[model samples]
Target chain A: MNKGLIIAIVLIVAVVLFMTQSDKKEVSEPAMTKAPPPVQVEPSPAEPAAPEVSLQEAFEMNRAMYGKGHSFAWNGEQHTTDHPEEIEASKEATQANAEALLASAMAKNAEVAKLGFEWKLTGDILKKAQQSIDQGNFQQALNLAAQAKYHARIGIEQYHYAQANWHLSVPE
Target chain B: MKIIKTLALNLAVASASQAALAADSGFDMQTVDPEADRIALQNYFKARFPETEIADYVNGIYAVDAGSREQWEELEEFPPYEFDVEKGEELFNTPFANGKGYADCFENGGIGIRHKYPYWNKDEGTVKTLEQEINECRTDNDEEPLAWGKGAIAQISAYMAWTSRDKVFDIQIPADDERAKAAYLDGKKFFYAKRGQLNLSCANCHVQGTNIRIRADLPSPQLGHVTHFPVFRSKWGALGTLHRRYSGCHKDSRSKPLKPQTETFRNLEYFQSYMSNGLVANGPGARK
Candidate 1:
């Protein structure tokens, strides 16, 4: 009587436990499924966007690079030279800078009128960029713009650099 | 009271140290002696290039480069600059709209005066190039100043330089005036100063690279740089003033060029011309 009673009790308890465990699994599966899709979507595509940046952001980065770029070739900021669109933008910025500098040079004295030819070269390069754009040669446009920007930057630096360094060449 | 005495002692020591520092490292102004510079410069070129005749120095890099010189001499026979000289003569003799002429503002009727230019104007406290003088002459006569550095001004300069052939450069620095000395010194500084994106000075080319060649062109010795004005270049296919050449060089170095006749350019002209004191004027010359 003791052995039969013990066997029956064991079978009954095992069946009950198994049933409860299966119920729990069934209850948890849909909840887990429903919760995951949107959450997974949110993080993978959203926050630590490591690989890519927008064009505007890229341009800002470029500006920072040229303004404070790490290359010894530039004052630290290497202009956005590698990319066509960014180079085009940089050309406009440089042209504006050159024009502003030219005006400033003029205001100090009307003698700045003499630098018309240098500024004309900037305009000519810009024109070349436009032609490149018309020809759908964006890379060529970028190259031209890059060259124009360099000239513009140089033009802006011309008067001041001369003023600052001319005295250094003075005989002691 | 003790603090006051300590402060007073510190001040005295500071003054003494500063005085000593100044004595050791002062501003160190170089006295302007154009004649001495001319002699030294001549000796330098002469000693460095014993084969080159002193008179031939005015011929620029050609004087030292026989290969380029042989080709250059043949080119000079026809002398493409002839048209420019003729045009310049006409422009020089023409009167301004104000009924006054260029002759009215210059000595010797503006003829044979290229060697006398880039003079330090004692009254103006600035240097003036022949280019500047030509513009000034026009402006003084109620005509607008000619555009210096190129074009018509260069033509007039070409004519003037041609007419002034055989005349020696005679740049002066008044020994009594400290400003003149400062101008000359400043010009020298500019010549030697490392500048631009390339960090080059005038000396980098004219002084050091005179014996060297880049591609096909040789940098000429600085001895007679001023004797050639408004040179006709094969590359330009047009005449260019020395200042125009200066601007181009600066641009090549990734630096901006100052306006023509600015104190910087003028002072440089003054200094360079002074160094070329005895070189014969052989401007309106040709170059490749």
Candidate 2:
């Protein structure tokens, strides 16, 4: 073969070999790296994993949280007091706090009711709480109010969970 | 070239990760397709109860078990709601205080119209149920609106349903109206969404839990649920409308019941009636 022709042939063969190798790498590389990493679901803080709190536990928690006049937050509002002594010194002030808690429970119940997720006992419990208040039994009223609030909170959580997961129950 | 390859690989990996996340979340917000849903629901029951005839579903729990069906047939021979239907017929024909009566307001003097409701009223932009319209008819003619759930309302509904016996439900969600579609979707959401302290949806019992005993009673299949209404339940010992049954179910599930003829319930009836599209109306049924 002529010298120039032989050189050109060599270059062509080399180029074809390189192209073939590149195509092989392109096909095989994605396959090797295509295994998707396992997805980790971080439970939303706003959403409860399940309705785990019992009525008794909810009442006790509310008693500890509100009975001491300890400051706490719920539904994005801060329920607090600068004067703990004022709460302790005045029986009327304590009664007011109990009434306030009952009102809060009512508001929460109404929120869930709009979503059509209100529990049957929530309204009944709140009514009893109001009755207790009417009878001047502040402690009993507070307990019932706490229980009602618990039901309302759980209902709200259920509403959110259902919004996201309801389609799973749909028959395929 | 190496940089380009790395960028491509990274894009592929990111896409895969997003897909995996979506699968793990299992979040789906699908558009409302009533016809598709109806087919799936009917097919589900058919597959679930292969022996039960499709037409027999209007019989509810009795349709599932042969023993119960035999007893139900016996009960049917001396149907409990016969008296209610007769009273309903009288109430329906009696003229209102005004010169006009219920016959004046509806098509075909309101006979054989049970299956036509609960319909979407385009002008009202809401669902119009048979019971609701009955009350409206009374009020429109200078008469008092009847009490919902039971009593006169149920009696009237029973007479109307009797007139509609063997007529299949043909509820419509108008194609041109967004409100009608929204109402149906809302209702479907209500049916599937878990509520109350028990965390139970309507589907939990009637759909997935059909034929399964809950306490002493077996839950009925959701298919053809609306076919039989204004039932004379042995528990009540009186005739009651479908909303009465809905209220009872809510109480059973520990959820606060919505009032009868309310928007929520009217929409629910719209969805359920649509689901029972092909089934024959067999209302004023008797149940234990």
Candidate 3:
């Protein structure tokens, strides 16, 4: 009876210890190893790679995101708009992509001007995005950079259309 | 020689076909009657706003919008253009170093002569505006010409407009001048041509969009619009010429404005003024 009682007590203590260690591991996890936090994502370099998506996630994300836009025609007039929200592989990737878009949009300055459109408003939005980045509004900044890109693209098309119309009309 | 003959035959056939199509649709401007255009244009305006008198058309938006007209009448009490008019009169009367003033450059000593502007200059073979004549006047007297859309030009034009007050527009496209007719047609084309990102034309706003609220603003009828010149716009915070207003319209439509007094603009003025041929000058007008 005494031996059985001692074994039961020992098993109970071991189980208690195991559970306590598990709880400790859960509590002490570095945020990087866990899922990403909501907005104001400041992903550190030390973040562990997400187990679900690995080698081809970036390409897959882009392929899926870039093709998500839709177009429709109403009353004989065709209308189109973009999907501003993108499904990025990671918050850091989203930031990096936004930076690239900003650079490319800025580089197309001459092309935009040639299309007879000025980018003053777009440029101002870009400045605001930079300010947002410095002020820790990374997600907002990304959205704004995307808006600027959209404006630049639309401006280019409008410029070309106006230029063609002028040429055809005035021929001067 | 055989190939040339075949090409010539094909070209002649193509020309005949095009001419036949034009004849069917009456699509050519070559023989358009300016007098007919004026009558039709005035009739259209009169038919639309039956209550407004023919002469009152020169008052522009005021002839349509009673509330805005009341405000304008009140503003006219102090008359926002008074200072500019005074400055312009001083400038007009001031002689150049050679003792020649603007009066020396024009017939009738530059007074009561604004109605005759934007006329076809037979020698120059181009349309000339009041602004152009002012510049010519200055240059002839060995003085520097003012920038076309600048405040100084507007001020001078304001004084000229005031001097010619109530003189009905007498724009004439001489019977024999095809060049003048072509210019007039081109101006009409410019007015009606859809342009810019907004896909707007001068006609779209002033004709079709008249009395339609565009975010709390109404476009006035195109008739008699040319009667007003060097208008004091609250938005501009200063006097602006008719071309300046036209340039604003261009910019508003997201199109780059051609420089003031370009052949395109002068021709545009020639046709626009001709449309309101008998409306008296109601210029140096003030507006929001």
Candidate 4:
């Protein structure tokens, strides 16, 4: 092609590409911000095959899995309490844990409840203080807020202690 | 009839070989001892680097203990003694134009970190994983956050995890605060939220019906998920931050991926890590 003709063609092509890109951006900008349509995907294949285990292998695997999980029931139950001694020990431990958790939870509930009451009291105090202040008693209101702040601090401490105890009772 | 029987015999042998071939992958179902998985990780490393002796300093923790003891001491810091820590330190101090540093947000020079992670934020009513915490600090400081896979966040997370060696994770998200309560609730929801092509939630395998097969084995819920972020995974063939792991889960779910440091993932990390409280911190762990 002649130089002038080639240059003219190149310029036209560049203009066309730029126009197309701008058009695409204009079309896409609004769609970008909108909520996307729900996507429907094809279902996946069935699960991969499990390890082929003989009966003995399956039993051993189950035993290991159960052990890792700390599932200690043994009477045809979850655990391997094949021995009478294990059963007795497990039961005793379970009972102890249950008692401890119950006691701890009760204590926690009481502490948290006390804090909740304190918070309520603080709110009431603040309201009364606000009324007093509106009536031009700044000193009384200030005193009331100080008391409310004290109550709030106490509530926080109580809540923290209760929660800590609760945490201690529950094993990870 | 004779030809048909011969063909049948050949087919049977071929099928047996194929079955054996299928079972030959590194992870096999019947032989799955967690011990075996541990050994596989070892063999994989040995095969990858024949010269190096990767030492097992702590239980369930592995590191390349090559060179003299003094030289290995230098290697203890991750990114193989690169500008990783320095860049991380600079990134740590270089306050994004928004005027913030790691010290401003977290405790312990931002060291002894990972303790307050995976926290339930009752205010935002969501769990905030450590990754989310980092992203929160990054964004709050007016910086475009680092990508999760193998960048600044991973570098910093790795560095912090190294600094926090042998420390037990002790997160404190005040449940009494309304925000903390909300965060815990949201985190719990995320834990139970099912997604992916498999339609599995973290709780599905980790909690309820654990030990069911995905491929070989899935670790149980109690195995300290948060304690192993910035993990050097065999599957990934590279070091990755928790958010990268999150993104992998999302991709596995076939869900639209959230941005690194997005709220949903941060909350997910919070709930996941909360489940792993009391486990000793073991970040940048080598895993399959």
- Model 4, range B1-288, lDDT digits (tens) per residue? 665465346434533432332323222222322233234333433443365443332222223322233443444555342445455556666666666587787777688776556665556566656655677788887777766668778767777776776677666657356565345445554554444333444544443322223444333332356676677665776668877877766655443355666666666665555544555676666555
Candidate 2 DockQ category?
Answer: acceptable
- Supply the DockQ value of model 2: 0.27
In the range B1-288, model 1's lDDT, one tens digit per residue, is: 665465446434533432332222112265445565567557666766899998888999999988989999999899989999999989988878887777788899888888898887889898878888888788787778877767789999999899899998777788878888788877765675555555456765676556565444578878888898889989899998888888887776545567667788878887888888878898889988
**TM per prediction:** 0.60, 0.74, 0.62, 0.41
Assign candidate 1 its CAPRI class: incorrect
TM-score for chain B in model 4: 0.59
Top candidate by TM-score? 2
lDDT (10s digit) by residue, model 2, range A1-172: 7999999999999999999999987788767586778696776999845435654454457656677555654444455532322332334435786798789889989999988899998888999989988888887787778778878888999999988877666675
Measured with C-alpha atoms, the lDDT of residue B167 in candidate 3 is 90
Per-residue lDDT, model 2, residue B114, is: 91
Please tell me which predicted candidate would have the highest DockQ against the true structure.
Answer: 2
Candidate 3, lDDT over the whole model: 0.73
lDDT of 3 at B154: 90
List per-model TM-scores for chain B.
0.87, 0.89, 0.89, 0.59
**Model 1 CA lDDT for position B53:** 90
The DockQ of each candidate is: 0.05, 0.27, 0.02, 0.01
Please give the range of 10 consecutive residues that has the lowest summed lDDT in model 2 chain B.
Answer: B20-29
The best candidate by lDDT is 2
lDDT of 1 by residue, A49-142 (tens): 3435555566556666675332322332333424332333444434444343334333422232243224435555666766666666655665
Q: Rate the local accuracy (lDDT) of all candidates.
A: 0.69, 0.81, 0.73, 0.52
**Winner of 1 and 3 under lDDT:** 3
